[model samples]
Target: TAGDTAGDTAGDTPEDTPEDSPVEDDISSNKKGRFHSLGVGELLVVKQKLIAYEEGEIAHIENVMKGEKRSRNHRTLHRTEEFTSFELEKEEETKRDLETTTRFELQKEIDSEVQESTKKEAGLTVTGKYGPTVEFTANAGIATEKSSSKSKNLSTSYSKEVVDRSVHRIQEKIKEKRTLLTIDEVEVINEHSFGNLESVAEHTNGIYRWVNKKYEAQLFDYGTREIFEVVIPEPAAFLRYLATNHPKEGTSIPKPQKPGYMRLYPILGTNEFEEVFIPLSPGLLTKETYLKWVEKYNIQDVLPPPSSFIVTSIAFAIDPVDTGVEDEGDGSLTPNWRTVNMKNTELVVPPGYVAKIGTLSLAIFPLHRFILRGLFGEIAIGTNKHAFHQGGGIGGSETFVLSNETGLVPVAFSLTTKQFFSGTLEVQCRRTEEHMEAWQISTFNAIMNRYEVLKEEYEESISGEELFGSVDIQGKNPLENKSIILNELKRQVITQMTRQTFDEFDAMREGVLPEGFPQQDVDEAWSEGQYVRFVEQAFEWENMQYLFYPYFWGKKKDWPVNSRLEDTDPLFKSFLQAGSCRINIPVRPGFEIPINIFLSTGEFPWDSGEGGIAVENEDGEEERDIFLSIAEELKAQQGAVYFKSDGTVFHANEDLESVLTGDLIEEVNDDGDVVLNDDGEPVLINGTNFLEDDINREINIGGKIYMIIAVNEEQQKITLDENISIQESVQYGIGAKAIGVPWVVTVPTSLVMLHDGNKLPEIPEAP
Candidate 1:
């Protein structure tokens, strides 16, 4: 009774809840995290360490006879008292009880928590933690419950079961082969793909899910870089079967290796004639030679434009890029934290730009409420959070134990996407309501902190809001209400830097000097000294699109996007200090447009170890700067529309208008009018900037009025419908097989005869 000083609530202990009192109960109930069996080599190593630390030479150090010039000390006291230490008896006993009660409780977790103790391989030595401290390894020489044995056993069983099930299901599907599916049957397939990843028989229309599983979604390309559409009797059911079924050994279900994701769309009804928008797995819908196509195709701007990531915000903090902040210290609050302000951080990652956010960029954009209200679609407020809480203790103790007065400060805002220009987007914002108390475990002693509730409640009730809806086209800045996908209580540096500048820009324009930092005001005006040229060029540049800032980047195994980072190095350092941490990734890149941005980790190509951005292990740290470089080159398609349809017809800018119709009349360049030579053939413009490769060239195809068509690599012919061409009534289509995917060559004007009868057979065929 004396040791139990508490209000009488029983049946469990270590309460893991916000609503529950500090001692409400059952907290350690789910403490199990990781487990692994011991290897023979590892066992020997541990045993050696324990022996050395225990009864080895050091045990009788000073006791060695004082002969010659060797031993002078009286006693080199033995630090090892074996596994049972009388000093730590009380807590050790309690831990033992907890494990004996729960058989599955893993020693790995204990080892992780207290490394020095459990690491030694002293045969059957009690792990000081009490009950299961003496966890055995399969290679422990004698009878020991090795963690590897359990893992191997389970893995083998799972594999066998999967094989058996796949065979059984295939047989079933074949037996029940049916004909044209009805709409009901089709929708079922669609719905299944939405959920089950391996359900072969459960063909789904579209494989849509909280694939990010969390509320948010990130868009990614399928293998082919296109919005792939494989039409089956029941698109949904087929996809479902594909998803729910397991792949055979040695073979895996085709998946994006680096990104590990793909967005799928469903084809409905028995319509072989239907053409659905290919979802972006690329190859499915990735960018190609758009230079030749842009003016000719008449399509809007492209998604995932290239550019650098810069920070502009009000809640700015500036620290040496090297310094990192953490939980128990003043790193976060260091005066010189932000380099910019908050509002200024709101940015549009320009088309053709990839903003690589360093920690400083994030510090400027901390936990501000970013409200995204589209007049054309769903309106909501959210912040992608690098999860933090203003509470005590390590885990969620300080977080979840909150007073009934409030909810968590950081809550989730899930959203649905609409066609953004010609692309899709996943949008996350900064948090708005800091006062909102999340889950808490409050009692006579304390209350659950704000952030804890969010961690707990995220999995279940996040979908309460109607994440989707259409919008009314009205205002100019319709998405005005600021909803930050990442929210923080304090200011980041970038916010400060930019805010000062913006305010100065406003002041100078109005002929008024604000209070502090007059030079900052002047500098702000100076940074934009080139504003005219930038704006002019921006205006000159075509369609513009906006993307959210980087909130959190992580692996798929991480929880929902919870962790926050200000600068890359610092944020990473902070994570390193946290031991084994699991941050949220907003984890969705499919179904939504890239509302934002991944870290350089295990999944990325240039990783040294599992999830090692800073290279805690290994050498040869090759940075993955090349992939982004490639994507950039691909996005900036720089060439004229090469049309090799009838012959070598090249069109650029306005010349591409109504290109497929009749003789394409153009205002040619005076230097070389893209005209025919004296022999009535294409006069090759040697050394033109238009050609990236001498052998291969790109050409635009479709247009609003008339599109350009080219001929195949081998065949020097392009057949057009009688309506399109004035010469012959040929209904043949244009084919250019030589122009391998992406890079294409346009046909010359002579090959395609005009209705008005203008013909110049000058251009030669594409080699």
Candidate 2:
């Protein structure tokens, strides 16, 4: 019934229906038949047309289809299930076809619209409100309604956006190229103006005047403007001085043709002036012009040329009061016992004064007399009548020339004064020697060779010793005692050798020679007298063996020497070998005095002082007569005592009582509690003995006296008086007084003589 009604409606509106409508009379006359007859292509065309239809028309068609379906279902309600199924299938197929066609056509329309839009954009040219234009062209399409819409949207502010983007790009570039100022630079800029106003005005006026005379072209020309933009863009100022070419002549400005040399005269008016070169250019500033300007402005007074003067010699005028002498003492003669004091002397060079010696210019500074004395050592001002055979001279009047060999000037100025003194001072120059003599070289070589042999012997025989003949040395182990003795010996040997060699060299340089040329006889009487003195010292000591072992040694080997016994090699090739060879006679504590081998017929040059040991005589009675007999023999052979110019024999008294001293292993607190180590054991001084034997012994710690009440031998610790506290590593000495013998030390007086008889105060004897 619904199909019949649809047919009726279509027939009624056939004439009224639009001509372009898809459901026209042809399709309406046989709707189902026509739809079935149509091929895929025909059906697709119909579907496309239907899709283009308005929503109202599609809805109407859908409602009509639903009504028809419902009417058919009612009609088939009583029909067989098979027939119902066939009708339903047909209906579903038709619906599916329409739906597929609709979707395909809709997608096609959308694609068409997108393609049209792309074509419009491809050939688009947009002009912005601020006059910036952007133009684009397509290869094969014309612009459509979408293109016009896009243009309308962008045109309003496109030019402004372009300007903003360009500015942003320029800012980024400037940021990359600009130099950031430091805090100080920024502060300076904020605090001060760029240039002095007066100076800038004067400079500008000068430039203006210069430009007028030099250039012929107008200042505001196109070329000039371009230059100003390129070189001086910000302030619109011209830098005409930088121009190289003359506009009218088409030629570069000529450089100055003046001499490339000049001289700077000192403002203080000295004949000595330094010559300098003028690096000339095309600019207005030349050396001559600059000098002329300086002269006109009196700039020399403000910035004067550097000046220099030579100080040929410097001397200290010592006043009598500053000589360390009191009014109660004799002024003319220096007291034999008193030392000269120079603490109050003020020695300084005036400021702004430079001392020039040849090419060397030095700024002298003030130096304290104590520092000077410590370095140069009591620089005596005059000759001594008793020390030097020369006549007595003015005490502070004579100026002794220091020999360059002494190296006093360099040592004092470079090392001592330079380190201590800050202000200006004077310097003393020394005389330099040019050459050496043949005999001096030979003698020096001999002495050096002898020294080397002695050193070798010491190393071989003494330094490598396993035992020192059961003698107790400094309460140290055999090996430790050997090391100590060896070190002390080495130190003393080096000191004495240096002094002796220097003295010998000086004597040779000054043409002062010993009376006997090279061959000299040994003074047996003087040797005997020295031995007697050593014997007396040994008698007074508790352990005389200490003195004998260190000072007295049996001859181990004979050393090679020249005919004069002065050198290892012969002074003359044809000379016969001397009957007596040279040997180093031990003077104790590592010092040795050169002597002939003929000094003693016995194995040792000196007595061991062990002859007093008890020995039975032929009568079976113990006798002390052996030492007495030796003493009598020594006295019988005595003669006038002789002194060597190079060596002086002196007795050194050392206290061996505290030889067993050691450093505290741990800090002792004020509470006087026992210090503990990391493992919780009582701390003790290593390598020390503080047991039952050392209990109750008084000890000195850090200069404070304390009595040891308890001793821990296992830990090497001593319990001291509760009142005393000692720091870690503080040295402590035991009060055990051991027998100590005084030893003879043969010190060379050459170094002392260098000070020109200025003797240092005698050191008080140790208690």
Candidate 3:
């Protein structure tokens, strides 16, 4: 009820909640802060455009052609070349999709079921005035209103109704339910009977698609050829989601369900974002569509009035104690809990995208619930191989930089879904790097080869095992499940691979090892018999290096390094081949592939504490200040422009919902104007709610030139008349072709034209 118009104070990070080690994070989400990440789809937009030097003046892609000569009767005719968009290989895309679906094989973590999920369960009361109710009836089919008189015959209650008295009681309770509840207040402590959530088709063949941006998602026909994968943000948000929205809840909270993208995206945020999207197919219920689907049959009444569904909140500080920047910890980074209010909840929408038939900005963006999904590791590719790394445990003894000859790292997705609310969690890591070897890339040629055959085979096997060659997801698929293909692929990759697996030395790569890993040799290599001797040697090197050049990571910038004594474990020496990770020849894109390696160790040695996770590189002061300022500016503009930036410059055009309320690229400036990205080169937008029109309405870009492009509306429709080969399509379909630059159509405010420049044709819009 109490919203800080100026926003609230930041909260402490979960890491700061301090206890023992970062192992398994014993901290509850309330204390833990959520982590944010930019998806590959988003990176695909500004990856190349990123400025090499943050402080250097850089040149932009020249827009104006050198001195034009347009005299007398000569007129320029700009050629309009068509892109000739083609359909991607559906079969291959399907396989990739299924593989991701099978990724969540792990079960639940702690056993805590949501006993009863009800907004009004606490029985809080507002005691407010009543609004007028309208007569309405429960229509059977498509919304073609029944006789007005017949509808009017219905009884009276809250907002609008034409139903029975029993319906009236339930409806009133629901209305009160919504008004009395806030997301934080409405807790689903346990799972309810999601009444037979599996598919009810004749053969039990079903698949599901969940689009989670907040705590809810819309279920869809997993059978759709064009749709498949889902994305999630980082760890903290996701963990919270799991703790709150898991199926453990009872009748109090109906299986947390929401509508389709169009109805939900605006509520999430204003951009296509990182989500813990599961390509799962929940089975069929009697309910047919998202808008009217009823999971709990006893419910009836006015639908809950619109409210913030998913909220995004960020808490941060400039300095951290871990950096030891200050002796008294004055510079320590901290989370400001005051910022943890409801108003801080963030929702987003994609850029250059809009509602299907409205002036609305991009819509149908994903919403995440309890859990936000994301990359726990980073992967890089080089010459014949690549390197991959996940955050390692805290400590110097087992610390390492494991290098692999073959870039094939096991790419597996595992989630421990608690089968029951209250019980001991028996997590038996089942999903292996089944398709670990298929991931390939060439930085030189800029080609990234991925082998999904293994993933595809596994899906096929899953489909067959589910009684009658199918399992029950939320709904039924028109075709058979592809789990069989996924299973078969796994069989081949696993039974055939020699080096693409956990190695004997894997436990010793560097950092903390799982409880039982070997540790004898490691102790000998870094034997610190006399702390005094080592300390003396360290001081000598630091003094010598300091005279020549500034120290880097303590040593001189170019100090010749010796292998860490800590790396005596042989795992660092072993190089595994990734050839079997795939079954096909490679296709490389631009840029030479850089080798990548992964050990059990984390990318960063530092682990999060009770306070929070380690503060990332960017403090985002310039970006943060500019963004806050823009939000203030938007109030004057009636929510026209929203901002998303990586503390760098260019911001992508995001949707209005996100624009209205999201982190600003620029915080409020002294004069209270939108901050410019240095007022120079083309701005690289991470995501935005601001448009070209907003430039004039908000701030001055100093008349900067930004290339505007139109979208290929027909891109979504791609079955063709031409003859095509499956292999060729598979190579390019789901891989790189889908990743690219925004369409260059019209400027943010510039208008397209009719021949006479008087009137233009009207077209239905979409997100």
RMSD in order of candidates: 48.7, 68.6, 49.2
- On TM-score, who's better, 1 or 3? 1
Tens digit of lDDT per residue, candidate 2, span 535-557? 33222111111111210121112
Instruction: Please give the lDDT score at residue 397 for candidate 1.
Output: 12
Quick one: ranking by TM-score, best first? 1, 3, 2
| lDDT, candidate 1, 178-250, per-residue tens | 2322221111111111233343433222211110101111121111111111111111222223333333222
lDDT of model 3 at position 41: 23
lDDT of 3 at 716: 16
TM-score of each: 0.16, 0.13, 0.14
Clashes per candidate (backbone, < 3 Å): 198, 7, 198
Of candidates 2 and 1, the better by lDDT: 2
Q: Against the true structure, whose lDDT is highest?
A: 2
The 10 consecutive residues of candidate 1 with the worst lDDT sum are: 42-51
Q: Residue by residue across 313-359, what tens digits does model 3's lDDT show?
A: 12211121121111337644322111010111111112111111111
lDDT value, candidate 2, whole model: 0.26
